[model samples]
Target: MNVAASIADFETLPRLQRARGAGRIAVGQIAGRTRLRTLFQEGCAKIRLPRPTGPAVEAVLINTSGGLTGGDVVEWQAEAQAGSRLSITTQACERIYRSSGGAAELTTRLRVAASAHIDWLPQETILFGQSRLERSLDIELEGDATLTALEAVLIGREAMGEAARDACLSDNWRIRRDGRLIHAEATRLTGADIERDASSLLAGCNAFATLVSIAPDAEARLEKLRPFLATLPHAGASAMGERLVLRFLAPTGIALRRSLQPAIAALSGAGSVPRLWTI
Candidate 1:
């Protein structure tokens, strides 16, 4: 076998891109104020900033590879100690490119202490053509703790006039409070099912978002959030007990963000969205 043929043989084999990341954050007491006590990370993921923002600590997550493709693995874990207030966001959007091999996987786990407050607000996840992604999130909240999490999924690149064909996405979320499961949501979209179920499930929208807020005041704030939902072309808002759920669908990410901007700010109870939000 010649050297050129030998090298060509090696190149013909499947090429795999792999990455593993883990992050940990814990709160502690600092002069009678809650502060981060432990922050650990490994692999391609890093915590860009873990600083104090008003009454809470804000943490920004970063992925150095710029994007995730086939066979990539990513994981993040965060914990807020008792009486702590923590806010988390990503530095930019997570792009999922086409996968010729196995699916890319992502795992996230969150723990909130009693009387603590957490805001898990990351940017969108853009899916490219023929991409495959599987993700799971598990959250544990103490009896009096509060949590707010947001996720946005974009089917394709709008500016490039791309389309998501043969893409697969599976997302599962489990939320528990006081050792009891309160909410569980699972979504699976296979290759053909993407365009097949669009009319009924997604209303032909290529982009969508889900935001959940759980707190003692969640129900009481429903009235304040209703007006925001009424303005969207496609949106739904509901409050049940300690949980407030918001759903959005739009033709593009920009449209969806605009439609959800008012509701997001209202539910977050902040003057603005997360600092990581693009524009």
Candidate 2:
């Protein structure tokens, strides 16, 4: 009986502000050099490609919205066609601010065609007190394609005197080759006791990093990577078949990066660290 009036009222109702964005990129080999095939970006998600590095392509991801909070969502996708090589890194660390309610969300999807390679090397994600974040990373590989990924997290900034005692985080990663899942892991952190628990995975560490690589030479690189990891206060490396995994934990962000940078450079396709890391 009052359908029109109700519809108008609903349409005029105030809505809570939220940040939303999505970005995608595809690369293909052309005359032995990787080149951009397609690129798309919207809202706060943006992708920038600096000058090419030899035959491989390097891309930098940027979040123009600055930081994320409750009700915010962002997504990114990258593809490497057959015989191509692509490396991606973020312009700076991602910051998660205090959330009033709900949770900030992030998703990333990667595809590697036959004989292709993709390196995902985003910077650290910093979590502030009372922040909430959920992140997922899914990857698909075909034939002998390869992938190298790195994820680093800072619970709080020691230099700034910040603490993440009340922060919440949930992260999941899945990797599939030939349509079969080869790697899967989930991590969750909640409550103020996380930092103080002696048996906790973090063990009082405020910063942590993880690196996973899948390639024909992945296992071979394990030995070389071990030395770099050994120098860290808390670090480990392991290899199985074509996959290599490494983890590092430290009391401060500065301490974590001291050894983490060299380890990444050793495994990087270019055998050098990303430029943004130095900046």
Candidate 3:
């Protein structure tokens, strides 16, 4: 075998390239105003701080790689100091493309100090046929800290008449208050789970979302949310102690947002949805 010829042939062969990114941000109160204290970004992960219209500092996350596929990894971290307010949202929907072999992974970690509030309102995540994604969210809160979080998933593009005939998703969430676990949930769904017609499952719906709020007044918002939830086709809200959760299902993303926008506005401590959600 000729050495130069063999080397050239090896370089011609196809190779798989994966995406990786990580970002971190911290905010604190500075002389009665919330301000950014620390910011970090690496790889394709980016953080942008827009001017605040109110007391809360807004941070927008961007994935410069455009989309994710098999073997991709991304991580995010956020911190809010005592008496500070922070709100975070994504620049747009996250797209998950079909994987050739391995599954993509996404992880998020958050910390809220005493008397602080953090709102995590990322946009919907859309998955295509044969796509595989694993996601985990972990949060820690101190005394009287508040958190509002939303996660939505779309099976496929409704406008293109697409369906996630073959896909896989594994999601996990854990929230703790003052070192005590307050909420924990795990969700796993395969193509077969999406095909089931059972009501307890997706029920043939292509879109779904879960919203959660943990605050001192969480239960107080239940009654105010019920009237609005009743107007939507498939929306429900329940409160237990200081935790409130809402679930929504719709045939399309538009219908799902119709209910989600209002519900978020009510539960969000700022009394309005994140500006990015409208834009």
Q: Which candidate is the best by TM-score?
A: 3
Q: What is the Cα-based lDDT of residue 3 in candidate 3? A: 100
Candidate 3 clash pair list:
none
The numbered model that scores best in lDDT is: 3
Per-model lDDT: 0.82, 0.89, 0.91
Stretches of candidate 1 off by over 4 Å are 1-15, 193-197, 269-271
Q: By TM-score, highest first, what's the ranking?
A: 3, 2, 1
Tens digits of per-residue lDDT, candidate 3, 33-140, equal: 999999999998999998888899899999999989999999999999999999999999999999999999999999999999999999999999899999999999
Model 1 Cα displacement at 68 (Å)?
0.8
Q: lDDT, candidate 1, residue 49?
A: 62
Worst 10 residues of 1 by lDDT: 263-272
Candidate 2: residue 246 Cα off by (Å): 0.3
Residue lDDT tens for model 2, 1-279:
799999999999998788999999999999878899989999999999999766679999999999899999999999999999899999999999999998999999999999998889999999999999999999999999988899999987787898778889899999999999999988788855844356447888888888998977877799877766666668988899988999888888888888688877878776777889999
Clashing pairs in 1: none
Ranking by lDDT: 3, 2, 1
Instruction: State each candidate's clash count.
Output: 0, 0, 0
Q: List the candidate 3 regions with Cα displacement exceeding 4 Å.
A: 1-12, 193-196
